[model samples]
Target: MTVQPIIFFPDQRLKQICAPVIEFDNALRTLTVDLLDTLRAAPGIGITAPHIGINQRVVLLDLPQSNMPEIYINPEITWLSDNKKQNEEGSISMPGISAPVERSVTIRFCYTDLYGKEHTEEADGLRSICLQHEIDQLNGIFWIQRLSALRRTRLLTRYKNI
Candidate 1:
């Protein structure tokens, strides 16, 4: 597997809802590997298939706490806590700019692994934020959409300058 070029912001593909991964095969495994490589190259903690222009519900997160990258396919949020917290968020697709976005402080989500095994997990803090952010990408909601209009405009202006 090789690192693929990231699809930059404003790309229509980034806004298109990704199709669920129906098959668990070599192709899916390769895509996961490529995603991991690209995420590492982008030096990002998390990335979605759409970030690389793939219309598939796949995400890879390489958090420092994990021994290796974690892959999630067809992930969906199952529960969100009433508590909220703000964290700086950015995207590999939209490099160079980030804005603080408020998200549920705790969340429960379900996803399929590369082997097609379904799993549910709970997260809090940065992990909670990352899961929600990447899941948004899968649903065709770019992270910026979570920002206020003024904040989004300012972030886009800064991105343009970069």
Candidate 2:
């Protein structure tokens, strides 16, 4: 498998709702590998499978790891913290802009792996943001979509090269 270019914003495929992954077979394995390659090639810490137009529920995340990258298939958020933390949010989907936003401090996640084994864990800090970001991609949403109308309008105008 090879790295595929990440889809940019306004790409209709990035707005598609992804379907659940039904099989733990070769196609799924290949997708995981492609995601890995793409993530590494993008040099990014995370990528959602649907963003590549596959419409499958999977996310490739490396969290800046040098070697051990984590792949999550059909991931779901099971729990979250009451307290929130603010961080800079941006996406490959919507380049050239970053915004500060508040997100959950901790999140519990459940997903299947490449081996078809189910796993569950809680994550905090940047990991939580990464998980939430990837999950949003699966839902056909981008970080900018979460912004207020004023902010979104400003962003769109900015993208118009302000």
Candidate 3:
């Protein structure tokens, strides 16, 4: 397992649409390990393949290390709760910043595991937020995109100066 470098926000690779997982084999096993190591070293809860400059539909997420980390491969959201909550969300890409953003309190998703087995799971709390946040990466989006126009503008300006 290797700790991959995370590409910060404003990096062009972050915006690229990722490729789907194919040829699930030993290569994938290594990729998953690298992703997990990278996320842990990021000391972050989640990471998308593109963040490491690999345009593939994969992500790694672990909440504070207490919770077992989850790996999602070609993952898709299946359902969500109407209930929403705002939390102070941060990302390695953003460096030293975080902002409150609204997210669904519950979500259901499906994905193929490294062994090529399909699985579906429901998540809530930080897991919910993590899934939504990570799923957004599949579509080339960041949580900041969900912020209000005023807040988005302000954040952009703040980061620009940073």
Candidate 4:
């Protein structure tokens, strides 16, 4: 597996709504492994295929303290909790910028495995946050978009100067 280069913020590909994974082929499998390697190398807990300019609805997450990475292909959130939580969020695309983004404290989502098997599961805490974050990326939503206008401006300014 290769460590793919992450696309930076302001890249048009990062803003695209990724297409669903239709064929579970060797290329898709390779992309999944490459995504995991790239995310680990970036030292981020979560990532999406769009982060590397691939317009596919795929997400990978390795929550803190977890030994194995979780792969979600063509994932969709089916349910979301009323409760909300604020977690510090960052993106590999937009390094040196992070903010507390409010999101559902729990979520239920369905996804396909590399072998084309489907699974549904619920998540809470950091796992919940990571899933929501990565899913948003699959939907063309950037983490910075979760911030208030003022906060977003400040962060972008700071990141620009860095």
Residue 49 deviation, candidate 1, in Å?
A: 0.5
Ranking by TM-score: 1, 4, 3, 2
What is the per-residue lDDT of model 1 for residues 1-162, given as tens digits with 9 covering 90 to 100? 799999998999999999999999999999999999899999899999999989999988999998988889999999999999889999998888888999999999999999999999999988889999999999999999999999889988999999
Candidate 3 deviant stretches above 4 angstroms: 65-67
What's the distance in Å from true for residue 26, model 4?
1.0
Query: For model 2, how does the per-residue alpha-carbon lDDT over 75-145 read when each residue is reduced to its tens digit?
Result: 99999899998888887666677787678999998999887899999999888988998898898877788
- For residue 87, model 1's alpha carbon misses the true position, in angstroms, by 0.2
Using alpha carbons, what is the TM-score of model 4? 0.97
Clashing pairs in 4: none
Each prediction's TM-score against the native?
0.98, 0.91, 0.93, 0.97
Name the lDDT value of residue 104 in candidate 4.
Answer: 96
**Stretches of candidate 1 above 4 Å error?**
none
For candidate 1, list the clashing residue pairs, or say none: none
The sequence of per-residue lDDT tens digits that candidate 4 reaches over residues 1-162 is 899998999898888899999999999989989998999899788989999889999999988778898889999999999999888999999988889999999999999999899999999989899999999999999989889999999999999898
Please identify model 4 stretches exceeding 4 Å from their true place: none
Go through the candidates in order and give each one's C-alpha lDDT.
0.93, 0.83, 0.84, 0.91
